[model samples]
Target: MANDKHEEIDPRFKIANREALIGVGLALFNFIWWFAFAYGLGSKPVSEYHYILGMPAWFFYSCVIGSVIMIILVTVIVKFFFKEVPLDDEGEESP
Candidate 1:
């Protein structure tokens, strides 16, 4: 016996998936930025390293500044791109 029944998918899942992808993209970008700066500048010998605000150039840019940039970027992304979806099913009638 084969019974066929199709269930409708919740539209909220699509929105959530899009938001999740955006978050993953941001994380990938953050990792790339950190890796590039950390290795690109830190590859030099300690004697040739430059200091920024009393910290090594690579450490300052890759850790301190990278964190600040990520914070601002996430803030802007959430403020402008993310949608506010209601979590509760408000108007449905119970069976």
Candidate 2:
């Protein structure tokens, strides 16, 4: 016997998907920023390298500064764009 029941999808899933995409986008942006700084500045000879706060320019910009930037961005995005949705199934009940 084949049971054919089509239950409507929850609307919260859409919001969740959008938030997930934003996370992926942020990750991609982080990767590009890291790659550009790490390779573009790190390609120079050691003798020609620059220092920032006693750290190599490439490392400082790629790892240290990049992390601070990402923290701020994530904080802003979550605080402004993210929603607080209920995790339980109570909202799915029908009258």
Candidate 3:
């Protein structure tokens, strides 16, 4: 019956859904950034080096800028969206 399929979901699953969405988004972003850096910059000629600050532009963008962006994103997402879950129900009584 339709009612059987509509049984109440556990509360932990609600939190899990939100966290999974955020994680998937972050993973997609990482993949896109990785591809862009590898193909967009890595495709250039080896001798044609563009320096940002004594380092190749590709390195600067992929390593420094990309790292900073990822760090900021992770920090913001974890701080704002992630919830702390109990490791174990040590103190809770069993039914």
Candidate 4:
């Protein structure tokens, strides 16, 4: 018996899937990183407000560094988990 409800997929589905996942993943990572970097909302505010190597609490960039760290973590995760695809000349699939 034919299961007519089943949908057919193109042979190149994996290529599109990887590209889309990576694109969205990178975009999401960048957005989260940027917000974290700009807001500086995480962690406790410095009570001392003293200069740590000539940097004040409000002026210091622990959040920015954390965002960078987040990006690195995402990058590593994507690299480790995602499959690799080779692009053709002009960065388009060769027919």
Candidate 5:
């Protein structure tokens, strides 16, 4: 069954699948961090504030600094981990 023609996998498909899984992992990381920040520090009283860049520490880290980090990470991921795959049907064989 493994040798069957129908079981053959394209290299491009494998690359695409890998990239998708990595994207999902990054998204999950972001979600967990956001949830922890929103419920953890956000539950505290207002007078407990420590400011960074004129914003509350939690908001600055979660929204501003986190965004910058994510942007850099995503740029590196796309530049190094992803491949350009042809989506055209020109090379496909028709029965």
Candidate 6:
């Protein structure tokens, strides 16, 4: 009877929950940085780097900072909140 109940839950459920939290966190960062760059206060790129792409310095800085922040958040989430579960072949939770 206990086995029957345990068999109803998949090990992947915990993984999915962790992933959903990470997705939501990243989505928030996307919203924040996009708003900052597009509608909020950003560095005034009065100067441009004479690179091959001719991109503004502020844009480059934003990209670097954004990448660093995303990496940090992902690392924190994976390290702190991730849960591991062993599953059976039939998608059942282990005892």
Task: Give residue 59's lDDT in candidate 5 (0 to 100).
Answer: 83
lDDT of each: 0.88, 0.89, 0.77, 0.56, 0.78, 0.62
Cα-based lDDT at residue 63, candidate 3: 76
Cα shift from native, residue 6, model 3 (Å): 11
Model 2, residue 50: C-alpha shift (Å): 1.1
The positional error of residue 27 in candidate 4, measured at the CA in angstroms, is: 2.3
Which pairs clash in model 5? none
Model 3, position 62, has a per-residue lDDT of 77
- What lDDT score goes with residue 92 in model 2? 54
TM-score, structure 6 vs. true: 0.52
What is the Å distance of residue 95 in model 3 from its true position? 6.0
How many steric overlaps are in each model, in order? 0, 0, 0, 0, 0, 0
After superposing candidate 1 on the true structure, give the runs of residues whose Cα lies further than 4 Å from its correct spot. 1-9, 92-95
Candidate 2 regions exceeding 4 Å error are 1-9
Better of 2 and 6 by TM-score: 2
**Candidate 6 per-residue lDDT over residues 16-36, each given as its tens digit:** 766898799788986687557
Best by TM-score: 2
Candidate 6 ranges beyond 4 A from true positions: 1-15, 38-57, 89-95
Judge candidate 4 at residue 30 and give its lDDT.
68
lDDT of 2 by residue, 1-95 (tens): 12122122566676798899999999999999999999999999999999999999999999999999999999999999998888777845553
Candidate 4: list runs displaced more than 4 Å. 1-8, 40-53, 56-67, 86-95
TM-score per model over all chains: 0.84, 0.85, 0.71, 0.41, 0.81, 0.52
